[model samples]
Target: MIKDSPNPPEHLFAVRPNLDTETLLVNASQDLASISDIAVHLAFEVDGAQRNVALGICRMLEGVQLLVNKALDEAYPAT
Candidate 1:
Protein backbone atom coordinates (compact mmCIF):
# COMPACT_ATOMS: atom_id res chain seq x y z
CA MET A 1 0.00 0.00 0.00
CA ILE A 2 0.92 3.69 0.16
CA LYS A 3 2.53 3.12 3.53
CA ASP A 4 5.32 1.47 1.58
CA SER A 5 5.52 4.16 -1.06
CA PRO A 6 8.95 5.65 -1.41
CA ASN A 7 8.87 8.21 -4.21
CA PRO A 8 5.97 10.02 -5.91
CA PRO A 9 4.30 8.79 -9.13
CA GLU A 10 5.50 11.09 -11.93
CA HIS A 11 9.06 10.02 -11.29
CA LEU A 12 8.05 6.43 -11.85
CA PHE A 13 5.23 6.43 -14.43
CA ALA A 14 7.48 7.90 -17.11
CA VAL A 15 9.35 6.14 -19.91
CA ARG A 16 11.97 4.05 -18.17
CA PRO A 17 11.35 0.89 -16.24
CA ASN A 18 7.92 0.35 -17.77
CA LEU A 19 5.26 0.17 -15.06
CA ASP A 20 6.80 -0.78 -11.76
CA THR A 21 5.14 -1.24 -8.39
CA GLU A 22 6.36 2.14 -7.33
CA THR A 23 4.58 3.73 -10.27
CA LEU A 24 1.31 2.12 -9.32
CA LEU A 25 1.68 3.16 -5.70
CA VAL A 26 2.45 6.72 -6.64
CA ASN A 27 -0.50 6.95 -9.06
CA ALA A 28 -2.82 5.42 -6.48
CA SER A 29 -1.68 7.86 -3.82
CA GLN A 30 -2.22 10.87 -6.05
CA ASP A 31 -5.62 9.63 -7.16
CA LEU A 32 -6.66 9.16 -3.54
CA ALA A 33 -5.48 12.60 -2.56
CA SER A 34 -7.35 14.24 -5.41
CA ILE A 35 -10.54 12.31 -4.67
CA SER A 36 -10.42 13.13 -0.96
CA ASP A 37 -10.31 16.84 -1.72
CA ILE A 38 -13.51 16.93 -3.79
CA ALA A 39 -15.70 14.14 -2.48
CA VAL A 40 -17.93 13.94 0.61
CA HIS A 41 -19.31 10.40 0.75
CA LEU A 42 -16.85 7.84 -0.67
CA ALA A 43 -18.78 4.84 -1.96
CA PHE A 44 -16.39 2.25 -3.34
CA GLU A 45 -13.66 0.49 -1.39
CA VAL A 46 -10.54 -0.95 -2.98
CA ASP A 47 -9.17 -4.31 -1.84
CA GLY A 48 -11.83 -4.73 0.83
CA ALA A 49 -10.33 -1.96 2.88
CA GLN A 50 -12.16 0.69 4.87
CA ARG A 51 -10.93 3.57 2.72
CA ASN A 52 -10.28 2.67 -0.90
CA VAL A 53 -8.37 5.76 -1.80
CA ALA A 54 -7.98 4.82 -5.47
CA LEU A 55 -11.65 4.09 -6.05
CA GLY A 56 -12.62 7.23 -4.18
CA ILE A 57 -10.43 9.11 -6.62
CA CYS A 58 -12.24 7.59 -9.59
CA ARG A 59 -15.58 8.69 -8.16
CA MET A 60 -14.30 12.19 -7.52
CA LEU A 61 -13.05 12.46 -11.09
CA GLU A 62 -16.51 11.61 -12.37
CA GLY A 63 -17.93 14.43 -10.27
CA VAL A 64 -15.26 16.80 -11.48
CA GLN A 65 -16.08 16.10 -15.13
CA LEU A 66 -19.73 16.74 -14.44
CA LEU A 67 -18.94 20.01 -12.70
CA VAL A 68 -16.71 21.05 -15.57
CA ASN A 69 -19.40 20.26 -18.10
CA LYS A 70 -21.93 22.23 -16.09
CA ALA A 71 -19.60 25.20 -15.99
CA LEU A 72 -19.05 24.98 -19.72
CA ASP A 73 -22.76 24.87 -20.38
CA GLU A 74 -23.42 27.88 -18.16
CA ALA A 75 -20.69 29.85 -19.85
CA TYR A 76 -21.93 28.98 -23.34
CA PRO A 77 -25.64 29.18 -22.40
CA ALA A 78 -26.73 27.34 -25.56
CA THR A 79 -26.07 30.39 -27.71
Candidate 2:
Protein backbone atom coordinates (compact mmCIF):
# COMPACT_ATOMS: atom_id res chain seq x y z
CA MET A 1 0.00 0.00 0.00
CA ILE A 2 1.07 3.61 -0.75
CA LYS A 3 -0.21 7.04 0.21
CA ASP A 4 -1.69 9.24 -2.50
CA SER A 5 -0.48 12.45 -0.88
CA PRO A 6 2.23 13.33 1.60
CA ASN A 7 1.56 15.03 4.94
CA PRO A 8 1.31 18.81 4.91
CA PRO A 9 4.16 20.88 6.27
CA GLU A 10 4.11 21.59 10.01
CA HIS A 11 5.11 25.24 9.63
CA LEU A 12 2.46 26.60 7.32
CA PHE A 13 1.93 30.37 7.32
CA ALA A 14 -1.22 30.98 9.35
CA VAL A 15 -2.54 33.38 11.96
CA ARG A 16 -2.04 32.16 15.50
CA PRO A 17 -5.29 31.51 17.30
CA ASN A 18 -4.06 33.16 20.49
CA LEU A 19 -3.42 36.60 18.94
CA ASP A 20 -5.43 39.46 20.53
CA THR A 21 -7.57 41.86 18.52
CA GLU A 22 -5.10 44.72 18.77
CA THR A 23 -2.21 42.57 17.61
CA LEU A 24 -4.20 41.20 14.71
CA LEU A 25 -5.30 44.65 13.59
CA VAL A 26 -1.75 46.00 13.81
CA ASN A 27 -0.39 43.14 11.73
CA ALA A 28 -3.18 43.58 9.18
CA SER A 29 -2.44 47.31 8.87
CA GLN A 30 1.23 46.63 8.27
CA ASP A 31 0.49 44.03 5.64
CA LEU A 32 -1.93 46.31 3.79
CA ALA A 33 0.58 49.18 3.83
CA SER A 34 3.27 46.93 2.35
CA ILE A 35 0.95 45.74 -0.41
CA SER A 36 -0.09 49.30 -1.26
CA ASP A 37 3.54 50.35 -1.53
CA ILE A 38 4.24 47.45 -3.89
CA ALA A 39 1.27 48.37 -6.06
CA VAL A 40 2.38 52.00 -6.27
CA HIS A 41 5.89 51.00 -7.29
CA LEU A 42 4.63 48.52 -9.85
CA ALA A 43 2.30 51.14 -11.30
CA PHE A 44 5.28 53.32 -12.12
CA GLU A 45 7.10 50.38 -13.70
CA VAL A 46 4.26 49.42 -16.09
CA ASP A 47 2.66 51.12 -19.11
CA GLY A 48 -0.86 52.05 -20.26
CA ALA A 49 -3.64 49.67 -19.19
CA GLN A 50 -1.40 47.69 -16.86
CA ARG A 51 -0.42 50.88 -15.09
CA ASN A 52 -4.06 51.81 -14.70
CA VAL A 53 -4.81 48.40 -13.23
CA ALA A 54 -1.98 48.70 -10.73
CA LEU A 55 -3.10 52.18 -9.72
CA GLY A 56 -6.64 50.86 -9.23
CA ILE A 57 -5.32 48.13 -6.97
CA CYS A 58 -3.34 50.70 -5.02
CA ARG A 59 -6.50 52.76 -4.47
CA MET A 60 -8.40 49.76 -3.18
CA LEU A 61 -5.53 48.84 -0.88
CA GLU A 62 -5.46 52.37 0.45
CA GLY A 63 -9.12 52.09 1.40
CA VAL A 64 -8.51 48.82 3.15
CA GLN A 65 -5.48 50.28 4.94
CA LEU A 66 -7.60 53.13 6.22
CA LEU A 67 -10.15 50.70 7.61
CA VAL A 68 -7.49 48.56 9.25
CA ASN A 69 -5.75 51.55 10.81
CA LYS A 70 -9.02 52.83 12.19
CA ALA A 71 -9.76 49.49 13.75
CA LEU A 72 -6.29 49.37 15.25
CA ASP A 73 -6.67 52.83 16.72
CA GLU A 74 -10.04 52.02 18.20
CA ALA A 75 -8.79 48.76 19.64
CA TYR A 76 -5.76 50.38 21.26
CA PRO A 77 -6.35 54.08 21.75
CA ALA A 78 -3.38 56.23 22.75
CA THR A 79 -3.28 57.84 26.17
Candidate 3:
Protein backbone atom coordinates (compact mmCIF):
# COMPACT_ATOMS: atom_id res chain seq x y z
CA MET A 1 0.00 0.00 0.00
CA ILE A 2 1.18 3.55 -0.76
CA LYS A 3 1.67 6.01 2.10
CA ASP A 4 -0.26 9.29 2.09
CA SER A 5 1.55 12.56 2.74
CA PRO A 6 0.04 14.67 5.48
CA ASN A 7 2.03 17.90 4.99
CA PRO A 8 3.04 19.74 1.82
CA PRO A 9 6.69 20.48 1.02
CA GLU A 10 8.11 23.92 1.61
CA HIS A 11 8.83 26.22 -1.32
CA LEU A 12 12.24 27.82 -1.86
CA PHE A 13 11.92 31.46 -2.93
CA ALA A 14 14.61 33.27 -4.88
CA VAL A 15 15.92 36.70 -3.93
CA ARG A 16 16.09 39.33 -6.69
CA PRO A 17 18.56 42.14 -5.97
CA ASN A 18 18.17 43.90 -9.31
CA LEU A 19 14.48 44.74 -9.01
CA ASP A 20 13.50 48.30 -8.04
CA THR A 21 12.03 48.67 -4.54
CA GLU A 22 9.58 51.40 -5.58
CA THR A 23 8.26 49.27 -8.43
CA LEU A 24 7.89 46.27 -6.11
CA LEU A 25 5.98 48.38 -3.60
CA VAL A 26 3.64 49.65 -6.32
CA ASN A 27 3.01 46.12 -7.56
CA ALA A 28 2.38 44.86 -4.03
CA SER A 29 -0.11 47.65 -3.37
CA GLN A 30 -1.96 46.85 -6.59
CA ASP A 31 -2.10 43.14 -5.77
CA LEU A 32 -3.34 43.81 -2.23
CA ALA A 33 -5.94 46.22 -3.60
CA SER A 34 -7.21 43.44 -5.85
CA ILE A 35 -7.40 41.07 -2.90
CA SER A 36 -9.25 43.64 -0.82
CA ASP A 37 -11.69 44.21 -3.66
CA ILE A 38 -12.38 40.49 -3.79
CA ALA A 39 -12.95 40.43 -0.06
CA VAL A 40 -15.44 43.26 -0.43
CA HIS A 41 -17.35 41.23 -3.01
CA LEU A 42 -17.23 38.15 -0.79
CA ALA A 43 -18.43 40.17 2.19
CA PHE A 44 -21.74 40.75 0.42
CA GLU A 45 -22.17 37.03 -0.27
CA VAL A 46 -21.65 35.98 3.36
CA ASP A 47 -23.52 36.98 6.52
CA GLY A 48 -23.01 37.88 10.19
CA ALA A 49 -19.58 37.09 11.61
CA GLN A 50 -18.05 35.87 8.34
CA ARG A 51 -19.09 39.04 6.55
CA ASN A 52 -17.74 41.20 9.34
CA VAL A 53 -14.45 39.29 9.27
CA ALA A 54 -14.10 39.74 5.55
CA LEU A 55 -14.83 43.44 5.77
CA GLY A 56 -12.31 43.76 8.58
CA ILE A 57 -9.67 42.07 6.43
CA CYS A 58 -10.54 44.28 3.52
CA ARG A 59 -10.10 47.37 5.67
CA MET A 60 -6.73 46.20 6.92
CA LEU A 61 -5.47 45.51 3.41
CA GLU A 62 -6.66 48.93 2.26
CA GLY A 63 -4.77 50.55 5.09
CA VAL A 64 -1.61 48.70 4.15
CA GLN A 65 -2.05 49.59 0.51
CA LEU A 66 -2.38 53.24 1.41
CA LEU A 67 0.86 53.12 3.36
CA VAL A 68 2.65 51.42 0.48
CA ASN A 69 1.41 54.03 -1.95
CA LYS A 70 2.58 56.77 0.36
CA ALA A 71 6.01 55.19 0.54
CA LEU A 72 6.25 54.98 -3.23
CA ASP A 73 5.17 58.58 -3.55
CA GLU A 74 7.82 59.70 -1.07
CA ALA A 75 10.46 57.68 -2.89
CA TYR A 76 9.59 59.20 -6.26
CA PRO A 77 7.71 62.43 -5.96
CA ALA A 78 6.75 64.80 -8.82
CA THR A 79 8.67 68.03 -9.30
Candidate 4:
Protein backbone atom coordinates (compact mmCIF):
# COMPACT_ATOMS: atom_id res chain seq x y z
CA MET A 1 0.00 0.00 0.00
CA ILE A 2 1.25 3.50 -0.87
CA LYS A 3 1.87 5.93 2.06
CA ASP A 4 -0.44 8.96 2.22
CA SER A 5 1.31 12.21 1.26
CA PRO A 6 0.89 15.32 3.42
CA ASN A 7 -0.67 18.39 1.76
CA PRO A 8 1.17 21.70 1.70
CA PRO A 9 -0.13 24.59 3.77
CA GLU A 10 -1.84 27.52 2.08
CA HIS A 11 -0.27 30.96 2.06
CA LEU A 12 -1.60 33.54 4.52
CA PHE A 13 -1.76 37.32 4.18
CA ALA A 14 -1.18 39.74 7.09
CA VAL A 15 -0.16 43.27 6.03
CA ARG A 16 -1.77 44.90 3.03
CA PRO A 17 -2.11 48.41 1.55
CA ASN A 18 -5.02 50.61 2.55
CA LEU A 19 -7.56 49.44 -0.02
CA ASP A 20 -10.05 52.06 1.14
CA THR A 21 -7.86 55.05 1.99
CA GLU A 22 -5.46 54.62 -0.93
CA THR A 23 -7.78 53.08 -3.48
CA LEU A 24 -11.26 54.12 -2.37
CA LEU A 25 -10.47 57.79 -1.78
CA VAL A 26 -9.03 58.24 -5.27
CA ASN A 27 -11.29 55.75 -7.02
CA ALA A 28 -14.46 56.70 -5.19
CA SER A 29 -14.07 60.27 -6.42
CA GLN A 30 -13.43 59.17 -10.00
CA ASP A 31 -16.29 56.71 -9.85
CA LEU A 32 -18.58 59.42 -8.51
CA ALA A 33 -17.68 61.78 -11.36
CA SER A 34 -17.87 59.49 -14.46
CA ILE A 35 -21.07 57.82 -13.28
CA SER A 36 -24.17 59.01 -11.53
CA ASP A 37 -24.26 58.77 -7.74
CA ILE A 38 -27.42 56.63 -8.06
CA ALA A 39 -25.56 53.82 -9.85
CA VAL A 40 -24.74 50.68 -7.89
CA HIS A 41 -21.24 50.37 -6.48
CA LEU A 42 -19.23 48.28 -4.02
CA ALA A 43 -17.91 51.25 -2.04
CA PHE A 44 -19.98 53.28 0.38
CA GLU A 45 -22.27 55.56 -1.66
CA VAL A 46 -23.05 58.32 0.78
CA ASP A 47 -24.46 61.77 -0.09
CA GLY A 48 -22.22 64.40 -1.68
CA ALA A 49 -22.16 66.58 1.42
CA GLN A 50 -21.29 63.46 3.37
CA ARG A 51 -18.83 62.17 0.75
CA ASN A 52 -15.54 63.57 -0.49
CA VAL A 53 -16.62 64.10 -4.13
CA ALA A 54 -20.01 65.38 -3.07
CA LEU A 55 -18.37 67.44 -0.36
CA GLY A 56 -15.97 68.92 -2.91
CA ILE A 57 -18.88 69.78 -5.19
CA CYS A 58 -20.79 71.21 -2.24
CA ARG A 59 -17.85 73.47 -1.37
CA MET A 60 -17.78 74.93 -4.90
CA LEU A 61 -21.56 75.23 -5.09
CA GLU A 62 -21.63 76.78 -1.64
CA GLY A 63 -19.31 79.52 -2.82
CA VAL A 64 -21.58 80.30 -5.76
CA GLN A 65 -24.66 80.09 -3.51
CA LEU A 66 -23.04 82.39 -1.01
CA LEU A 67 -22.24 84.97 -3.67
CA VAL A 68 -25.79 84.82 -4.95
CA ASN A 69 -27.19 85.07 -1.44
CA LYS A 70 -24.90 87.95 -0.64
CA ALA A 71 -25.84 89.82 -3.80
CA LEU A 72 -29.53 89.23 -3.16
CA ASP A 73 -29.16 90.28 0.46
CA GLU A 74 -27.37 93.48 -0.56
CA ALA A 75 -29.93 94.28 -3.25
CA TYR A 76 -32.79 93.76 -0.84
CA PRO A 77 -31.81 94.28 2.76
CA ALA A 78 -34.31 93.69 5.57
CA THR A 79 -36.08 96.89 6.65
Task: Give TM per candidate.
Answer: 0.34, 0.82, 0.78, 0.36
Candidate 1 error regions (>4 Å): 1-46
User: What shift in Å separates residue 27 of candidate 2 from its native position after superposition?
Assistant: 0.7
Clashing pairs in model 4, backbone N/Cα/C closer than 3 A: 48-54
Clashes of each: 0, 0, 0, 1
lDDT of 2 by residue, 1-79 (tens): 9765577667768777998998889888889989999999999999999999999999999999999888888878999
lDDT of each: 0.56, 0.90, 0.88, 0.50
Q: Write down the lDDT that model 2 would get.
A: 0.90
Superposing every Cα of model 2 onto the true structure, what RMSD results?
3.4
Q: Which stretches of candidate 2 lie over 4 Å from their true place?
A: 1-12
Considering TM-score, which of the candidate structures 2 and 3 is the better prediction for this target?
2
- Model 4 collision count: 1
On TM-score, the candidate that comes out on top is 2
TM-score, cand. 3 vs. native: 0.78
- lDDT by residue for model 4 over 36-75, one digit each (tens)? 3332231246755456665566555555556555554565
Worst 10 residues of 1 by lDDT: 38-47
Please write out the lDDT profile of model 1 over residues 1-79, one tens digit for every residue.
3486576576555555677654554555566556655443453422445356655665767666566555545545665
Q: In model 2, which range of ten residues has the least summed lDDT?
A: 3-12
lDDT of 3 by residue, 19-67 (tens): 8987788788889989998999999999999999999999899899989
The CA lDDT at 6 in model 2 is 78
The candidate with the higher lDDT, 1 or 2, is: 2
